[model samples]
Target: MIRTIPKPKKSKRHFLWLLGMKLMISSLLIFFFMSSCTKEGTISLNNTNDNIGAEIADSITVRTATYQLDPLPANGKGIMLVGEMTDEATGNLKASSYFRIGNSAISSVTLPDDAVFDSISLALPYQGYYYGDTSLTQSFTLHQVTEEIKLIDESNAWEEDEKPVFGSGSTLFTNNTFRYDTNPLGAISFKPKPTSKTDTVFVKLNQMFGEDLWTKVKSGSNQVTNSEEFLEYIKGFVLIPSGKTPALTAFPTDSILMNIYYSYTRTADGKKVQENLQMKVDDTTHQFNSLQIDRSQSLLSALKPDAEGELSSDQTKQQVMLQGLSGLVTKIQFPYLHEFVNRNDVIINKAELTIETPPSSHTPYTAPSTLNIMLADEHGVPKSLLTASYETTTQAAYLVNDLSGGTRNSTYTFNLTEYVSNYRGAMEDTKSSLYLTIPVSDLLTKADRLLIAKSDDSLPIKLRILYTKY
Candidate 1:
């Protein structure tokens, strides 16, 4: 509820140790939320105050209230590579995905004039960066994406809770367990010379598929000439893990491709030699890693959305959940702004939100370096704080830093002054909500999440609003 303050004073970073929050405002909802709110009710509003420059004798009212919000909508997968990983610490989350691969035009132009097919292998250059324990063995299995490896971005089907079905997908490649160890799989990865660190991981595919590919190449088929034609013959590959390991993020098919090894006979002066040939990845085609996340075992899985769009207290009493890829965002609303409207014009000098990381009793995870937020829209789309930089962090809604947290307060704080200012500007029209999340900005389509404290905890989520009423 909106607590009253007598008079006001101020406040004010680019430091890291991210503390996060997000939201927007509309007048109508603000009234409904902020009305009937009272804290101690000690500071009295002046009886004669309808004027512009009314003297505000009392100290500034600082009120804190927490609002529950529905989960955020899924983000469109824009990254290039297929990022798959399961984190036991992060709700037993697992990512299963598939994508189409095409032969590079350069290599596809024509097979060796006198070439014969040998063996085929799928090469995936590891991006080198992984979220969980890379040292641990992560078993992976690749299947033939027999069905068209369609991109889900073209339709709204991806928005649903369940992932899109590759539809009767078939595995051309036999299901084999490829184990990922400290020295992950790659031709160059495990070289004895080991002059440089290996960044690529290779998985040899079924030889018959390569034979089929070579068959088509010998027929002078268009499949060898263009990716569009090649995809028709063999759609793509569906990647899944044998057992759950934290995560394995791979590069795009551009860096990752199916190399069809072949050999040609050459007679050099009286000696015969075997020469090698390869069919590389068509860098033009874009392969995506669409993630289907399983959150049943994670901390946030306990949270179930209520029918009426309300968050369950028991389900989310003490923790703020930021599930990655699966799109679970913490929604927060300021429900006491109407109390400020009832009195008169109040200048919200600074309204900062501080969310503390629940200190771990057993083991503590690394704090997210940067927390991000965006305005929550009723239509399931993202809205902004309506500020100069709502879309970017240049003028973000929330951030946690030592500067704001007194350099030692392990909590993060955000200036909600803009939110309050908009509310006062359009009293009856002010209504909006904030969606909190972990930012994903990679072709690997990978990011870690935050699971901090909520309002019901001993150290409840706080919104400290400093306002001066004139």
Candidate 2:
């Protein structure tokens, strides 16, 4: 036999309703006080409380992981990056730029018999872009490509969102490389002056190499007469940096020129006249930077080049990383979010995320000026970029500078109110994680990187939420 209990009387029910009202009023006051202390922004609500509750929480659990992105398309971007560096964050890193050279002026070129070839040199103009230590002297060698600088045709290489804005065509990626002669044509060592617009570094080629090309032009060889044959003979050029460089530098592809100098006797006056021929970089579409990153000596060693996987922040010393130029990106997730989903009593008002950098993380390198946050699938592939409220533009988190001596003051923050509200109503399977990456415009041209501390008490990442319960 079981005993049944009777329902409460009307007076008692009324008393409980009054009690809930009191609790709601108290919670509202607490929430308001906390919000005022934060001084970030104001929270407003109706003056009357009708059986409703409010909550302010900053203890939400956030998970973080890091993974490598696919090879980035590096062709026709107007910038050529070349360098080599070794650091604990990215391990041994190397960058090389490959591009073909051609000149239409050579089509009608004729040389006199008395003309004598002078020295030939390659002129590289800097674009004021650099990473790592510029105080040290940087050294690199110019090599001749043994094979043609050709691109492989891939019909389905780019996804809809990953397609380049410049239009679609066969392009080269950071992982693509061409065979180059082991012997370099020329090499140079100099202190970098990236910010000087008028400064140009010139590397003189071997006399034999210059004379061979000079002789060909004088004899009107087929190799020097047509673009097709010219490319077949000279192939292309690759800028390879010595392993000793601690910085990566960028040069404008269009400004690169190969100059051939010569002197000829004037038939009428017998005066010696000097002249030079210029060969500009050809087919900007086929130019690309080949990047190689070795993580064997760093925390990311577990990430294999041939495998797709992610390493948790716990496994990486409670930190996640985001790097440009096909390097790495961080993923963020809320594991216990399901506990509050679909709750009829709760109404999420605002959600803000803050990610901080570790101490000394900015010593030798500066963090990216801005970062883009995107919704990502389980495999870490970006699905859609998170956008501003009621706007079609993608949202970006700008880095806040630190005035104090401490490096931890620098941070990246995001407004995730819309996402939080949607997550509360969406099905568990449809919910996605957030990915923090460098801006798309910087991926193939810049080597900016960021290191974010994982979420924890007194740590680098935090999420705060203001909500109401009814």
Candidate 3:
């Protein structure tokens, strides 16, 4: 039976088997295609530009940026400039090559290369320039050349040196260097001389003498004579017992004396005579009698006694008889009266009366007189004249009574005791002159008022005085 069925449809069965094998082959082919499409590669686009060269072309131009260089360092050293272009070549766009600039050059110079540019335009890996090693990247610009900075030259701060020539511009300071040249301003002064004490004294003494009385005398206007002048005028009168009259002759010398004389009278012609007067120097008992009349026999008799009776009665008797007879005859012969019948009257009587009279009854008379005397030493020491002696002469009395009256008789006696005693006392206590009184009236009356025989006078009165330096 199998045989018979196969035969009828074998063609359809074959068609179906072939269609199943085709379907399996198609499935395997699809699996192999999927595996090949999913496999990984060794070369990456991020690793190299050649791997993605065309792909990154737009980013390359857009990423790059321009840059400027930094100014040079101090002292003309170089400075650096860095930017982004060189960052890509090294796979680090933020850190790239830099350029250096110096003072002498106007442009920036690239490090690791001598390439220079008018201005630095560089790329840096970073957005801005930062510190980095020179080998990595650097750039710099040249600084302009300039003069060095200097300090100010103030006058207060200046200093000097021996090596330099300093001018007016030089400054002053407190070291050994400089000093102040101008001196301070203004003026100067001085003092005067002195005087002496001796010169002052001499001037005062000269002024004193100018106003003195002696100055007037020297000028010849002697209105009144002074004591000094009177003393000088009497220089000749002063006695010099020391024999120094030559020395005393000078003015105001050791001794001086002065004398003045004056005459006083009542009548012009009434017997102008001097009598009964005396004088003594320095109140002495010495009498200077009859200085005008030199003869004084009666005075000598009164002073001395009758020694050896040389004045006895017998001797006196014969003397008086002879003198009386001569006096009587002489009186009768001159100016005689004729009515005398008595020629026998007294001629018989006078000779007889004398012979009858005794000599013992007769007494001698002394005349009154005056004198002034002075004595002094060389130094004007007054000398006493109390014990000194003096004498003078007597004059005859005129008859005034008539003989008819039984011969009116008269007798006179002189006493010198009171005069001597009073003068002795005056000298004892005196250093100068004594005063004497002369009886002008008494002497005139006793002389019968005769013309030449009446009046008495005095002379040359002086005073003795002592002088001493002490």
Per-prediction backbone clash count: 27, 0, 34
Tens-digit lDDT track for model 3 on 129-243? 1221212222211111122111124443323321111112322110111111122111111110112212110001122222332233323333213433422321111111111
Angstrom error of the Cα, residue 105, model 1: value is 3.4
Each candidate: what lDDT?
A: 0.46, 0.78, 0.18
- True-vs-predicted CA distance for residue 338, candidate 3, Å: 51
Q: How do the residues 1-470 of candidate 1 rate in per-residue lDDT, one tens digit apiece?
A: 99988775332222221222212235544643343122212223323233323233222332222222232222223223333454443455445444555565333455546677777777665544445545446655667654563322423433442221211121211111121222222222221111224655667766766688778777767776666777777665656655645544544444556666667655455443453344444433334444444547755454443111334334554445554544555666656555664456554444556566544411223455555565655443444433331233433333344455342334655655556556654645324566555543321255455555543324445665544453
Model 2 lDDT per residue over 214-328, tens place = 8888888888888898988998999989858789888999889999999999999999999999988867877888988788998888886433467888898887887788557
Query: How many angstroms is residue 6 displaced in model 1 relative to the true structure, after the best TM-score fit?
Result: 46
How accurate locally is residue 146 in candidate 3, as Cα lDDT from 0 to 100? 22
| Candidate 3 TM-score over all chains jointly | 0.13
Output the better candidate (1/3) by lDDT: 1
What's the true lDDT of residue 317 in model 3? 19
Q: Which 10 consecutive residues of model 1 have the lowest summed lDDT?
A: 167-176
Clash list (residue pairs), candidate 2: none
- After superposition, candidate 3 runs with Cα above 4 Å error: 1-224, 235-400, 403-470
Candidate 2 — what's its lDDT?
Answer: 0.78
Reference-based lDDT, residue 284, model 1: 30
